[model samples]
Target chain A: MSIHRKNVLGAVFLAILGLLPLFLNSYWVDVLNSIGIYAILGLSLNLIVGHSGLFNLGHAAFYAVGAYTAAILNTHFHIPVLWLLPLCALTAGLFALVIARPIIHLRGDYLCIVTIGIGEIVRIALINNIFGITGGANGIFGISRPSILGLTLRTPTHFFYLILVFTLLTIFLFHLLEYSRFGRALNFLREDAVAAEGSGINTAHYKLAAFVLGAAWAGMVGNIYAAKMTIISPESFTFWESVLMFAIVILGGSGSIFGVLLGAALIVGLPELFREFASARMLVFGAAMVAMMIFRTQGILPPRPRSYDLFETVEGERKA
Target chain B: MSLLSIQRLTKNFGGLTAVNNVSFDVEQGSVVGLIGPNGAGKTTVFNLITGIYQPDQGAISFEQASLLRLPTHRIVSLGIARTFQTIRLFQNMSVLENVLAGCHCRMKSGILSSMFHFPRQQREERAAIDRALKALDFVGLRDQAENLSKNLSYGNQRLLEIARALGTEPRLLVLDEPAGGMNENETAQLVSLIERIRGMGITVLLIEHDMSLVMRVCEQIVVLEYGSKIAEGSPEEIQRNERVIAAYLGTEDG
Candidate 1:
């Protein structure tokens, strides 16, 4: 597609989305909020899984850490949930750095297995109420709602706008990251680590940075999730949650932002729409997933190879 | 002093000694060849020098600084860039992006700056693109800059690897089997490309099986046999060395 047409299509899509909540009922608005949240989470996981080619089946561990951090702080100390967003991100990022340091050297399926173990371990820890801060299996409760400019956001409509704004901001920032030097480095290392290292890219460092940054973004999303639900538990962050996020990235197009968002809508929103299918819904969903995978092996919106204007580069060189 | 020095280097894989007590020096502004029969440990030595595999014994120093435990990327940043025996370009990336990846260590724009496209980041990116384009032009793949590297012909793929390495702006260029599968025409092109690279004053270290190409370009040659250095000399001297000839074409009795 031409750049102009793509921009126009994107603008039209955003306009439709912006006008959606007005027409929908509370339940559908909440569903949109869910899609937005999952979209951000998929984008985060895409950095590690799609961009860097790291198998990460334990992203929920980081999301859980963020949610718990916010929940604990808000419930025990009465801190505003919004105020804990950065802290949640810090805690999750640190957690990823610590856990990933020793195991980052493991290759392929080994790394994937280790991540799965991590997700399970975090869930079990929360269940056991380690350090007595996690409140055992029942999980923390009564997380206060977020407020903005002296307005306490209470309705699904209120949270929708908040999530919409946050999702837009995430898209903007991640789009920049996707085109940057760092993004190229991730793709390079993903393609061939030995060659990337030989070409002067610090492969290990870039991989770990991707891990930490992805985890931090997931953590921020966790804070929003806690505020939206006003309650949290170990059940909310099972290994299944991680699988959903992973599927969203893979099903949408591993490295493409639009693919992830589409994946999120299909995975999260479709399931909701299928509610009327009753017991047969999951069966249909499974068959649809299988068909999608077979039809689009590279995902629905695989990332396009980056291109630069040769004449522009030549002009730049001449001017220089 | 030599630009890169290796002394008594050895690396063993489990029960087998892949490289044993190998020693060599790459002098400044020289094209050197490490040639041998298959499984002669030539590539192992290259790996050791590039820090892919640490030497079990002895030392490697670049510009008089110890390279003992430095990582591969660190070694490249210290001015040694190499291509693989098998072309390892980022298959899904554009040719320009592959070269841009090679320019990574030379450009420094942190995550925040990159995300924001800050003035410094934009400036560095522009400079990197220019450098990458120049390298692509050098390898005569400038017109295919936006093509996915995997889509290039085999010969062009090999040239793309060279362009990627040159993007590093290295002091020493190490190529593993540059002419492994090239035709006569491609090999001829590579010979001139090496001369042009040498004219740019970058030291060249290569492992090539094509004797004619090696004889035509290499100023110094190191011959290895079964993980041991059998001979080291100029092309003419190596041509006369009995052991080097025997290693390549076996003894009459055998």
Candidate 2:
């Protein structure tokens, strides 16, 4: 599409989105809020799985770490949930560091298997009440909602705006990262790790950085989720949640940020829209995912090869 | 003076000694050839030099610093770069991108500065792209800069590998089987390319099964048999060495 046409289309889409909360009921608003959350989640996962070609089936381990960190700090110490976003991210990033450090050497299916075990271990530990902090199966509740300018955000519309703003922030920062030198190195890592290392990129360092970055972003999302539900349990962060997030990255065309948002919309919003299907919703969804993969092996939007606009003819030497 | 020196280097994979007590010196601004019959461990020697396989015994020093136990990435930063036996281009990446990635060693942009597109980082990125273009131009693939690497033909793929290695700005360039499947015309082009690279003051070491290419471009040739150095001399000296002839004729053991 031409740049002008894309901009016009984007403007129209934003206009519809701006007017959506006005016409939709609170239930649908809540659904849209969830979609925004998953969109952020999908984008974070894309940094690792899509761009770096690391199979991370245990992403919810990091998410759970973030949610539980916020729940404990806010409910026990009363630190105000919003203030804990950075702390939540640090905890999850550290958790990923501790867990993924040794196993990062294992590539392909072995890495995937080890990560799966790590996620299960974290979830099971939370359920068993490790450190006497998780509140076991009942989970910690009564977490306070975030307040902005002395206004406590309580309703669905309030959270829709909260998630919307943060999601936009993620999009902007990740866009910068996508074009950055680090991002290009990650692409090289994904394509041929040995060659990347031969070219002087520390493969181990880059891979670990990708995992930590992705996990930190997921942890930030977890902070918002804890505040929204005001209660978080082990059930909220299951293996299935990790699978769904992975599915979103895959369905959206792995490395493309815009494609991830589209995937998140289809994955999160479609199920709610087809609530009329009742029990058949999941069956239909599974069938649709299978059919889509068959039709477009590269997802809805495969990543385009990156081109640096640095080919400008050096304009200084004219027949000197 | 030598740029890369190997003394009593050894590597063993289980019962087999892949590279057994192999030693050689690649002098500055010279093209050295490492040649043998198949399975003579020429590629293994390259792997050891690049730190892909750690040596079982002895030491490697490049530019007078001990390269023993330094990581592969660190070795590249020390002005040593190598291409693989089979073409190992970043297949999904564009031709320009492949060289840009090769220029990664010279780049000093950290994670934070790069993410923010700070002025220093932006300048480095531009310099890297220009250097990449220059490397592509060196191998005559500059016109295919934006094409995906996998779409290139066999000869182009080999040149692209050399270009990517050159983009590292190495003092020593190691190529494994640079003209493996090329016709005579392409091989002639490769001979001149190596000569051009030497003219640029970079030392070259290559492992080749093709004797004609090796005899043509190499100033010094090291012959190996079952991972041991059998002979090392000028091409004329190697051509008349009886053991070298026997090794090639497959009658050395008999």
Candidate 3:
């Protein structure tokens, strides 16, 4: 069957999921909500990791920025969680822009290191000086849930719908972005930065844009995460959490939107499905990632071009 | 004013000088070739002009604006674009998509408009797609627009690279080894294409090792050796210049 048909069927399958909360247990509903959050985070990382060819290991920094922004806004001012969603995303985007000038110049492992450092810094800061407001090691409690048009998301069922909507929106946005001009530019940059620049793409600007936008998407998810859990702490935005997001992108396929969602589901949902394997979870995850690198480094599904049959002859040339 | 002027442009790589004190003028709507032996810094000159490297001294002006300090994309926005010595089309993209990427800097849209698929962004995207198709057609690869750049034949890949460069609608297009790995027939086609590109009123600056191809198409030739200018003249004049002959053709008379 054609790729287009396959995509349509996938969409239809997802459309049927609007009623899943009716059948799923509350525990499973929580798993589903977590999957939604991770899917958005994974897809956001794909923009930089897959499309822009920039390795960002500290993506959780944006997640932290988002969480903290929402946490502080709601905890102190008693602001509505829904009102702070975009604000959180914008804050993370601005943070990305601030560091993008110097950071965008870094590549591969260096970029990874810097991002990792940024994540650590953000976490450390939250745990230290901001303790008065953030509650530091004690963490914040009584965090309010999101409400929409007088509807409060107090239960797993209610929040599942909101999370599901946001997750689908993130996927749709990423899908649109992957086919857009900016998406093409990021792909070009990923393939070859020099070539992309020569082609009249402002490589620095596009890289920065990708960084900022990716952070913003992750931030939106973080905002939802803050509301869902009704508590926040630096511990929630740890280095391992960032690594987990990276794992999702890499395990699924860095640039593929569906692959990201798939990765998120596997990483987030599998844990709940096999809670008996709790002690071996991290070990199994590590082994799977290593095996994937050894076997299918590109992930379960490599990112296919938006346009099919784009360059069959180039492959022929390589083979020749 | 001359369309492009480089006066005493110099670049140093640690202890080595890659581009040393070179100066030249490219008039508007002319095809100029930069030729040299291996490591002659021909590509280095291209790098300097395109903002890949900062010249230690001297100035580069395009349309009277100093391009020395401008970033690579900014230089491109100023109507200058280039291709690499190796074909560098976005390998996974369609020939049309690759060219469409080239057109990105020229198109205008707000972030919100692009994100929301606003009517304005859609119109610009449509225009860009049309322009991309036109560019591919110009390179005689319109039929291959849907083909992946990496899947194109070597010659077609080179042509796609040129087409992608042209997508920026540049007034000045720099080609690095346009006919680098092409067969004879492909080279002949490239010579004509070079002519056609010039006919489109775009000034061309090229670096090539293919002597016959360079001699046939380039109205002016600039020779560099060890990052320094050795000769600058018309192609006919360069063919006979003893220094060029010695530096390039070398001790072998043939």
Candidate 4:
């Protein structure tokens, strides 16, 4: 699609989403919120899995860390959960940086395997109740809803707007990053690390940075999820959660924002829509993914190949 | 003074020595060519100088600082850049995006600033594009800037590689077999492009199989035979050397 039309389409989609809560029933609205949360998670994973071309099956560990941090701190200190977004992001980012620092040096399938181990390790650590804080798999409760300017975001519409804001912010920020110098560097790493290094990009540094950023974004989303649900559990974040998020990124066309959003809806909403086929929903999802791989291997809305009409226009003017 | 200096560089893969006790210097703003037959290991020397391979022994200093122990990425930012013997453009990126990536070494905007689009970051970004465009113009790829890099014609792709390398603003640019696949016309364009790049005041170290192009463009030539320097002199002088001829033929007989 042309860049201009894509922007218009995106704006239209956002407008519909912005007005969705007023007409949709409570359950559907809540489902959309879940989709929004997953969208952020998918975008986060896309940074590592799609843009940087690293196979990471352990992303849920960071999400779990953030959710646990928010859950533990909010219950004990009564600090507003939303206020802890920065802390959530930092802890997850630092966790990824430290744990991934050693094994992130592994490439491709090996990296994927190690990340799986890391994710399992984090989940088990929470269940085992590290430091007597994690509640030992019983999980935590009584988490308060997020508020801004003293207004508690309690209703479905209020929660819709909450995750909506974060989703938009993620889209805007990832969009900027997709076009930024950092994004280009990541693309080079994705295509060929040696070539990227030859082009003067520090490939290893960029790879680790991508992991940190993706983890941190998911971590922030964890804060929102904790507040929205009003409870947290270890079961909520598992190896399966990582798999679902990775699937969303893949099914969405990895690096495409719209693709990811549509992917989130399909992955998060399809099962709900086909409640009669709840057992078969995963089978359908699997078939769809296989079909997508066969037909559109690049993803449904693969990020448009970057272009520079502006440069060509400037070149034209120079000649004229 | 030399822009780049190498001393006693060597590398081995098992029993075979790829580069053995090789030493060379690239003077500031001069075009020097390193030519050799297949498997003589001219590209190995480029890899060693570019920090892709740590020298088993000896030192590489660019503008009087040790290049040893530095990572490959750091080597580029230190004002040394190279192209591969095989084409290695980021095939999925736009042609312009590929060159813009080359400006990475010079661009200083950090991750936060870029995400936020801070004013200073915006300025650097614009400047970076302008620099990238100039490099593209330098290689006659200005019109093809908006196309996907992989879509470019093979000759254009080769030019795009140079544009990408020149985008790094390197003090010394290294090209490996740049004219390897080009036909006569493309080779002619490449010759003039190298001349234009040199006119921009960058030193060059090139490894090429095309002797005619090398003899025509290079002021000084280094010849390699079985991982060792067999000849070093002006193109005219080396063309007349018996050992150099024997090395090219892989035999001592007439």
Candidate 5:
């Protein structure tokens, strides 16, 4: 009900974007759709890395979990994709909870290493096992598009709308969560876990919440990918893909939602547009990341400014 | 029963026994001071009571319930809260947010409600904010609610830490060095503040170095020397104890 000015501008921008498919070709529209997916993944990653100050190296694990869950259910059980979206998100979230319980308990580099292991283990299992159901390394094909009533979501225009809706929803949800009390707890954890815990927070629960919610976002995007590509493969869920997601979050500014979107567009959109110079792209990105870390450790966007109205209760004068 | 009772509590760090068989009691609606020389293990006792360190051998009971094996947050939720000697605040957060985080244990909405922003969750969140504001108001920093805590002056930061702990609505509040680096006036103000806190009917346990302030405000004093309890008495009794005299002289001689 209390829509901020930023939300109003965002709504207007979305209204303009809704009409873009009328002007663009199917190929361009498909590329745009992919951008939406990447943006969602980037935003989700941002929650843990940027806002929560978690260093995640295996976010693609959740993305893969989402994609594979949708793929498996549709391919085996013939579940309708519309109904499968939430299911896939829940599956990914549950898997995240299970994996995060042990892995998220470890902080900093240890967490990164464990998540990397999870991502690798999941991808390898998908590739090596279940030759009959998953097509193993060859991957699953002929995955049908989602349909609503009698309308098939096979065309790029239709898929664009679907991806846009999910992406917008993800953005909306991320913003809402960031502004909530839970989000404040995450920010406290990010600043200093020990201090946050000392403040009487159940630090473990909040960290788990960040991991689960982030996975859910990635999973939703994964469902969209499964429908758009009509195929799901282990090759698509490589560990490097996880690293790339990390890159987007860092490049954009860890806690900034808009930063993630910009990061995703830069990382995913630029490479395709500059395919001729593909070999140098990653090298440049790596260099830029290094330089950015050195020059702008806070990233492109600054962390949210601390609001003083929130501090009105501490009656003492400033000390240190 | 006392508001807080520590019996035979012991903490060992490898070969170092940081706290050895320390036992004490905090009466409800009173201020108690834990004081000693720099290496006296006053902080270690606070840590043990707050569940930051597992006591090797002892029972800690609050309001007649055993707290020896409970986790830190659980201890806090049971109406025991504390501030650190080094002032551990959520520096990047607004002062109010730092305090609001202290209210997390009291939040009843499940994680599902939090993520979805359910109506109940919103109500709880608002209530938390209102409660945090009241805690901030108690500390007199209500005007700086939105400022990053790290930017505040040192004195205010100390107050902020206490206000944050107060957000937990503790019946027993432990402050580790509330006046560590403060000036004489600040220490005097702090002495009054501790009295006001005790006035609220909450038990107060503090570790302090300002001898004048501690002597003036504490109803009872417990002294530690090299991880051992040397004396326990009223402030006037502690100041005249031969063992207390020797402990301070030992540091001076060193």
Candidate 6:
């Protein structure tokens, strides 16, 4: 699509989304909130699985860490959940750094397997209540609702606005990151590690950074999730959650932001829409996913190649 | 003084010595060629120099700093950039982005600066883009900057690799079989490109089987046979050396 048309389409889409909560009932607004949450999570995962080409299937471990951190701290100390955003991000980022440091060098399927193990380990640890702080299988409860300027976010509509704003911020920041020197380095390493290394990119360092950054962002989303639900458990973050996030990125289009958003909508929102189908919904969803994979192997919206406006300068040089 | 120095470089894979007791000097601002038959370990030497594989016993230094224990990316940062024999371009990225990746080592934007587009980061990014474009222009691929690298012709892909390597602004540029699959016209263009690279005061080290192109562009030539250096001299001297000739064409007894 032309840049102008894309901008117009994006604006119209955002306007519709902005006004969606008013037209829909509470349950549907909550669904949009779910999509928003998944969209942010997918964007975070995209940094690793999409741009950096790291096979990270344990992303939920970071999310769980973030949620548990908030849940434990907020329940015990009565600390406001909103105040723990940065702290949650820190804990999750640090957790990723510790895990990824040793295993970042493993390639492809091996990395994927290791990440799956890590996800399971985190879930089991939460269940076992290793630190005695996680509250074991029952999980932590009564997370204080997030608030701003003395106004608590009590309803789905309130949380939707919060999620929408955060999602927009994520898209903006990630958009910048996607075009930055750092983003380019990640893409280069993803394409060909040896060539990227020979071209002066520190592959291991960049890979580790992507893991940490993606985890940190997911952690922040975990804080929002805890606040929205007001109760947290090991059940909320599972191998299945990580799989959904991964699928959202891959099925949506790995490297494109708009694609991930569209994917989050389809993956998260479609399942809800299919509820009327009862038992047949999953079969339809599965077949649809298979067909999409076969038809658009690159994703629903593959990222366009980057272009620069150097033509004018080049033409001027040629004339000169 | 030599720009890059290798002393007794040896690498063993299981029972086989891919490179053994090989020592050479690449003079500053000179084009040097390493020639050998198949499985003669020409690419292995490049790997060792670039730190892809650590030598079992050797001291490889660039500008007097040892590269023995350094990683491949660090080697490039210390002013050595290389192109692979198989043409390893970022196939899905734009031609310009491929070269921009080469400018990565020189860029200094951290995550926050990059995400926020701070003035310093923007300036550095603009400079990197200009440098990348200049490298593309040097290789005659400026017009294809926006195209995906995989969409480029095979010969153009090779040129794109060179352009990507040049984005590093390296003091020594290493190429593995740059003219391996190029037609005559492309090979001729490669010869002139190598000349222009040297003209810009960069030292070059290359491994090539194309003797005609090598003889025309290389000021110094090193010949390897069965993982050992057999001859080191000017192109004409290497062409006439008995062992070098015998290595290329089997001896009567053999």
Q: With candidate 4 superimposed using the best TM-score fit, by how many Å does residue B62's alpha carbon deviate from the native?
A: 1.3
What TM-score does each prediction get for chain A alone? 0.96, 0.95, 0.91, 0.94, 0.89, 0.95
Worst 10 residues of 6 chain B by lDDT: B122-131
Local distance difference test values of all predictions, in order: 0.93, 0.90, 0.86, 0.88, 0.84, 0.93
Better of 3 and 4 by DockQ: 4
| lDDT preference between candidates 2 and 3, better one | 2
Candidate 1 on A1-320: residue-level lDDT in tens?
69899999989988998998899999999999999999999999999999999999999999999999999999999999999999999999999999999999889899999999999999999999999999899999888888999999999999999999999998998888877899899899889988998899999999999999999999999999999999999999999999999999999998999899999999999989989888899899889889989998888899877666565455545542
Candidate 6 — which residues are off by over 4 angstroms? Answer: A1-5, A311-320
Candidate 6 per-residue lDDT over residues A1-320, each given as its tens digit: 69899999989988998998889999999999999999999999999999999999999999999998888899999899989999999999999999999999999999999999999999999999987998899988888888999999999999999999999999999998887998888898899998898899989999999999999999999999999998888999899999999999999998899899999999999989979889998899889889989999889998877666564344226322
Q: Model 2: residues >4 Å from true position, as ranges?
A: A313-320, B252-254
Q: TM-score for every candidate vs. truth? A: 0.97, 0.96, 0.93, 0.96, 0.94, 0.97
The residue-level lDDT of candidate 6 at A230 comes to 87
Interface RMSD score of each model: 1.2, 1.4, 4.5, 1.8, 2.8, 1.4
lDDT of 6: 0.93
Of candidate 1 chain B, the 10-residue stretch with the lowest lDDT total is: B122-131
In candidate 1, which residue ranges exceed 4 Å CA deviation?
Answer: A312-320
Q: Which pairs of residues collide in model 1?
A: none
User: lDDT tens digits, residues B1-254, model 5?
Assistant: 68888898888999999999888888888899999999889998988888888888989899999998888888899998999998888887788888888887788766466668998887677678878888888888988888889999899999999999999989999999999888777777888888889889888999988888889999899999999899999998998898899889754556
- Deviation from native of the Cα of residue B145 in model 6, angstroms: 0.6
Off by over 4 Å in 5: A1-8, A130-132, A306-320, B251-254
> In terms of docking quality, how is candidate 2 classified?
medium
Q: What is the lDDT, from 0 to 100, of the residue B130 in candidate 6?
A: 83
| Residue pairs whose backbone atoms clash in candidate 4 | A253-A299
For candidate 5, the docking band is medium
Per-residue alpha-carbon lDDT of candidate 4 for residues A1-320, written as tens digits (9 for 90 to 100)? 59799889979988997999989999999899888899999999999998999999999999998998899999999999999999999999999999888887788999999999998998898889899998888888899878899999998889899889888899899888887888878889999999998888988899999999999988998888899888887898899999999999888887788788888988999989999986888898789889999999987888888654354335325533
